[model samples]
Target: MGSPDPNGRQLDGLGGGISSLSKICVVGPPTRPGVDVEFTFVQVGVKNSDIDYSGNCGNLSSAVGPFAVDSGIFRPLKDSGDVSVRIFNTNTGKVIESTFPVCDGEAVAQGDFAIDGVAGTASKVKLDFMNPGGSKTGGMLPTGNVVDCMDGIRATCVDVGNPSVFVSAEELGIDGTILPDETQNMPRLLERLESIRQKATMMMGMADSPEEVPASIPKICFVSQRNSHMLLSGERLEADSVDVVVRAISVGQPHKALPITTSLSLAVAAKIPGSIVHQHARSGVENKEELVIGHPSGKLVVGAKLDDNGEVERATVYRTARRLMDGIAYWK
Candidate 1:
């Protein structure tokens, strides 16, 4: 059991500097079939480091459904069925309804599925983007402009959940397979990327620079195509090599796992006619249900419905999250 603060931030093991561990709760409507499911996020102090609630964890989002089902907060209606959960993130006031397959009247937790940043295999949980482009900025393109030239780089800025500026990795004199440590360790490179992020942030109308109050929006990513196996956890992932690869950063750090919404944005950008991801998308009707992206960790599969007229109906993917513990966490 742990103690949570007024805002749900946890406080435990505060003897040394450590990143805050998060505790989330998935609350489903007690008696309604299609009601909203509230997701409560808590930032637990890592015993020493700063407590952070500045971002929501999509990986934790994976655990919400299972937690709801396991806790009986949301009763299972069938042996194997689809359960939709409308997530109310207390931190951002954003709503995300993620659905997944259930087994034996319970949320499935075992399957032949694996994600880049996560450790082992688990059941496949899919997320559907209803609007596909309106999660963050309330519009497809946050700046209302498709292309924005900043710091001598041409980029496409869009907001699906977190705002991101998409550009090519080749322009930055690197392959798309750069490791997280290597990239983050390079102060000059990081500064340059941060410069782009600041400019893109301003372009997205979020903030002028890093000096200002950091907005929980607008991530910046560089993209390129990869022909080689993606390196993850010291292993290579075997998949179709696409021409467009994306490297995105959140809060000045390479996300261990790509945000679910950002991954959705990648799927849509891959389908659009003029974006950088156009070449990686399926060209014909023969195979149209899958979109796999090569990230620094590995490739992520995204499913979507698209039209020739450039309209994307929905984008989906499978992921896993688990409730590590529950109780209360004190912030202050």
Candidate 2:
């Protein structure tokens, strides 16, 4: 991928000039026992030379299994059926189990499963993050408190799939359903959120100072009670369809859709009493039921299971993936 392009567009390389599109996943043979493959998630800056390996990308995690199979790094036992690939993420030191259909030793690429941001339908990749808590920090509550006061507002800092900060949308004086472009117009709000994020990063022991904070880790998001809203696609999102509303910022930019890692954090936060997310989330959520999260793109259903000791056992989410192309390119 291209970098150091001050113009923001990676015209000389494969980067799409955005944080979500400018990601790289490196997969290979596992170095640990009981794991089929090992991978590293890299977040490359479009206009800078920053190569961040501090956190895992939940969306890209879906493709690592299929890539391993297609690239001959991992082989399935069956010829045409569902196959499971155990992956170890070096960035988060976590294991993600990827299960999907494979036909004749090749991962299936076509199906009817669909996701919010992507168009049409494709094969469903089930990603199960085992023992997901404390992805970056040493504990679920890095601050040693359910809620922390930062920037004169209450926030919940959780470290499930990744370290994340959740604040009330009303406290930010903004609509929870605000679109990405509209958020881009609010410089002051963005600045305030960044300040809180920097403080949270230090509190989570991820960085020593504001300048030392990585661009990707400790994602900050706003939460609100379920309410009818309009999505980026101009379609109506009914309040009853979702349990909570969220707007996330990634790499200092408003995300058009909620990051899968952030979604996992939210699911865990909602279960913690006195947290900002728990306060605003819908009440009477069943223990075994999946959580429906409303975002700028649409809704996503995520499941989080907690053990008897109140520790996160695992988090599950489904996504679709397809290999766009396969080839080699020369870079100057």
Q: Give the candidate number with the greatest lDDT.
A: 2
List per-prediction Cα lDDT, in the order shown. 0.61, 0.92
Q: What's the CA error at residue 158 for candidate 2, in Å?
A: 0.4
Over the stretch 53-92, how does candidate 1's per-residue lDDT look in tens digits?
5445555666776777777767766768777766566544
TM-score of each: 0.77, 0.98
Which run of 10 residues does model 2 get worst, by summed lDDT? 281-290
Show the lowest summed lDDT stretch of 10 residues, model 1: 13-22
Q: Candidate 2, overall lDDT?
A: 0.92
Model 2, span 1-332: residue lDDT tens: 88878998998899988899899998899999999999999999988989999999999999999999999999899979999999999999999999999999999999999898789999999999999999989799999999999989899999999999999999989898899999989999999999999999999899999999999988999999999989999999999999899999999889999899999999988888788988988896535358899999999999999988989999999998878899896778
